[model samples]
Target: MVAESGNGVHLLYPVDLLNDEANRDLIKGVLGTVAERFDDDDTKLDQSVFNAARITKLYGVVANKGDHIPLAPWRLSRIINAPERNAVVTIEQLRALVPVAPAKLPAAKRRGNYPAFDLLDFLTRLGIGYRQDMHEGRERFKLDHCPFNADHGCGEAAIFQKAGGELGFKCQHASCVDYRWQDVRELLDGPRESRAGRATANGNRPGEQNAATGTAGALRVTYRRVSDVQAQPIRWLWQGRIARGKVSMIAGNPGLGKSQLTASMAAIVSTGGLWPVDRTRCTQGNVIFLSAEDDAADTIRPRLEAVGADLNRVFVLDAVVESYTADGAEVRRAFNLKNDLAKLETLLIEVGDAALIVIDPVTAYLGDCDSHKNAEIRALIAPLSELAARHGVAVVCVSHLNKAGGSDALMRVQGSLAFVAASRAAFLVAKDPAGDGTRRLFVPMKNNIGNDQTGLAFAIESAEVPSAAGHIETSRIKWGAESVTVTADEAMTSQGDPEERSALKDAKQFLIELLKNGALSSKVIRADANGAAHSWRTIERARVALNIQVNRAGFGKGGIWTWRLPHTPPNTAIESIERHTNCAAAYEKSGGLCEEKPKRNEPDWEEF
Candidate 1:
């Protein structure tokens, strides 16, 4: 396209050059590669400047002058979008696109500058130097003069435009590594109006209400058609036991090793221990705990060390400052989960990549909220659940069971039903009905993410830990050999009172006294119990319940199975068993009653 003034000075510009992304950049190269000369005044065009056909066709929006065509922001897309290819100028309609706030002389500048501002030019104008080079297949500038460390002139600072046309800045220099992209914007283009009503660099208009949130612009919430929603794979913190980015509840009676088991898991996360059924290694990260119940030094830390956790990665969040004293000192109080969640969020940010968080007995930190109230419980847990999701951390909320024994383990959780309802998964730590009281089992009570998995067994072992005072005794978790094939409901079934467990224990002693001298076949043992006027099936149960081994030793026609005590001496066993033989209450107290003997023709009775 060519244009001539009434005085016959002609200007020529290639149409293709106007649409190039680097139109400003090529101008320098174009001037260096081509020569320019003034034309004679005697030269004449076929028509006058105002009557030129191409001027009318490509004028875009003629704001105030004909030489300067104000490219309409609305029709700039004609380079590709508009089919007619008509670039007719609309008068002054594109003035908003070329804001003249910085145009001191009011349109003295030509079309050489395109971007509202150039970062490189801004830096150079500020006496900062730069070097242009190719980066990631795109042109970028590396600072020859670091604004933060001008004396060192660190070469790590770089500037480039992002895919969406936003300018980005990054500095690998240690001193300026923390500088944000927006900080660079403030330095290049004068500091932006940092009020709510100001347009954000990301394109949000000042004080505009977000459509999705229906509130002040806080964050951008994007949506997609329901059919376009992609499904995310379920992530597990402990295989199927707990889920990541979700709140999991652990409920149990006190002293059931709930804290110890959780500490053991935290230790595993800190150390990158065996994770899956194959025991493959996973990445290690930090474990944070807000244990309101246990003493940090003696209980939490010792247990962590006992479980082989990286001590450095184990953090205990005790409390944050609640108020400032009159003397200008701080009055600190325990961190309350309901009120001080923002403080917890700050703590999570400080300890980034946290893998797990433990709020021992979440009710303890409920502050003034009533744990038993469903609404209040929901309110207390909502922020925490969101925090867990935002940080991709598994938040384990420890809880004790309601005193009501023998109810649904989920309902037994000491709080409103929301305690279990709000959690994605809930677990129960109970005395192993099959093992001694020292052994505990982790049973999945509720799992909304997947099928309820088989339970795992663990026991508490006494470990001596070094403390400021001296060595102290604390318990650490000892996982069982394999996961148990028991449901939480099944496990809780035998979770009877202490009296019942004691009765069964006493019956075992009675069985030992009855069989201490020699091994007896099942048939003969039942015969002896029947003859002695004791519950034969109950004695048989006791015989099988203890550590006694059952074997078949007789050969040929005399072959028979016998139950025998392995380590118990006949003399000592006889003396001990005497105390329990006459007590029928042992069966009654232990809730261990014998079923009637089966008929010979029917199926044989199963050994206890």
Candidate 2:
């Protein structure tokens, strides 16, 4: 087949000659003639080649030769004339032949032991072109030859030069920096130098690839082991403990000298004297007394003076109740002592460090004592505790005993158990039932930080009394039944008789009446009831007999003592009436009186 070109004819062999070396060389000679002729007109032959039929013909040629022939013309031509040529070439008939050399491999892939520049010269001999420019927008200029001149026209032979042991060419123009290599092997055989991974078209990883990159392993936590020598130091509730910061509850019934003891503590702490504990002393500082129950001018000042406290060092905030609110309803608001504590902070800052802050009769500052609400109680003490901790001051809160008392456990405290639970240490005061005018301040009803079995027992002597004038004395005593030995027989014998029980009940009723008006010291009330058939000891015995409990006031001058009813009087009365009233009519009315009363009555309602 033949195709026509602008100046000559393109002869296409009906048989694919590219598979035959003789035929390929013949075809190249014909094309080279065309190229030489076109060179005069400053033109070149346009070569368009396809491999579709060439591959099929190459297979048949290989089979006829009994082995595949190397495609390169130089290698194939040598093999064609060998002694085995008869066995290979005689099987296939020559359909057609053209005058052309075999097509060369791509220059970049060509390989030899020669240097790079020499190999590049060989590529120019193969009619390949190479050009370099400064990459102006997008154009390249030729330095050696003008394409418009026929004498120096572009062609494989005109541009390429064969250096020693090399077969490519370089432009000789002084300004031309362009050069073409004869072999492509140098480009392909060089190191790839690719990055670890391929970049996407938009230069980011795919979402899944990003997720893989973002994956992380689990984290580990480390804990250090500490030796005994490196352990944190423990704090005592008394020594530096009290001074460091602690909320101490000084509780007594009515007047077991709680206020007076608080006053003395204020005086001592203000003077930097040792507190009357187990002989252990605490460093003292300024004292602020928030006494809601005492008169500053008439009561606290005189009492503090009597105790020999420097009035200047002792600051008595006797008007906390008034300052917080006027009406008792506002008393709840007073329970939150934070605002008042702010003033306290200013005072501390002004006066230097304060060692102790006292809030007497804590019930007055508490929101609601009867509710037993934990949150209300917590709100009441949290700030106070915080203030103490913040300022490194000992906060002493005075509380009263509950009506239903027993051992100085959480339940015995006046308000919610949370009150005692929240405190660092709680001291309870109850009068000595034996009429010694001495009170027993139970160690701790509750002590979160220290021992609960250690407490102070002291006698309260009034300086105002003629016998005790100018002298305030207190004696320390200790008595508890934790390890006393009593035989079973002795215990049975000591039990009270029925008459004694009845007398105890009467005494209990009297004590209940006294407590209704607020706590009264057992000493003062005992003197008032001196003539009554029941002695203080007998009353106390009856209390124990009937399971009635009382808290003792600790020792100090003017230390007031008080008591609480074992049970509600109305309930007790109703119970007693139900048990005693056994007449048929009274028995029938028992259900109504003891339970609920009926609205309607019958004709026999009054009969007994």
Model number with the top TM-score: 1
Listed in order, each prediction's TM-score against the native is 0.48, 0.38
lDDT of 1 by residue, 1-608 (tens): 33323222334432333533343333322332232222223442321122112343343332222112122112221122224444544323333333334223222222222224455567667676777776533357777755534433547677765322335567775444445445555443432332124444445653566666676543333457988888888777666666779999898889889898888888888998975343645468898998888898767888887878898998999778878978999888878877799998898899887989998978878877755445556667777899889888999999987654443566567756667877999998988877766788888899898668677787788898777888878888777777787778667646756665565566777676655554445655676667765575456557656767776644664455566676645443343233223222244556865333212222121322
Which ranges of candidate 2 are over 4 A from the true structure?
A: 1-237, 240-243, 318-341, 367-371, 405-409, 433-437, 464-608
User: CA lDDT of 272 in candidate 2?
Assistant: 66
lDDT per residue (tens digit) for residues 1-608 in model 2: 33332223344434434455555434444444455455443454632232323332221122222112222111121111213222222213332332234344334322232223333344354333545442211123232342111123243222222111222333443212122331122222221122112334434432223344563322223356665347534244255224347787766667567777777766667676655644556565788777777777657776776676777888765443443344534342243353465666676677776777787776665432222444445655667778778777778778876544223234446655556666787766655443354644444555666655455555555553112344433311233433222322122222224465476668766664544433334554576567676678667755555454454444464233445444434343333233323222343566534333322212221221
Off by over 4 Å in 1: 1-224, 276-280, 467-470, 497-608
Poorest stretch of ten by lDDT in candidate 1 = 69-78
Best by lDDT: 1
Q: How does model 2 fare in lDDT?
A: 0.48
Q: After best superposition, candidate 1 residue 575: deviation in angstroms?
A: 44
Task: For each of the candidates, give the backbone clash count.
Answer: 4, 44
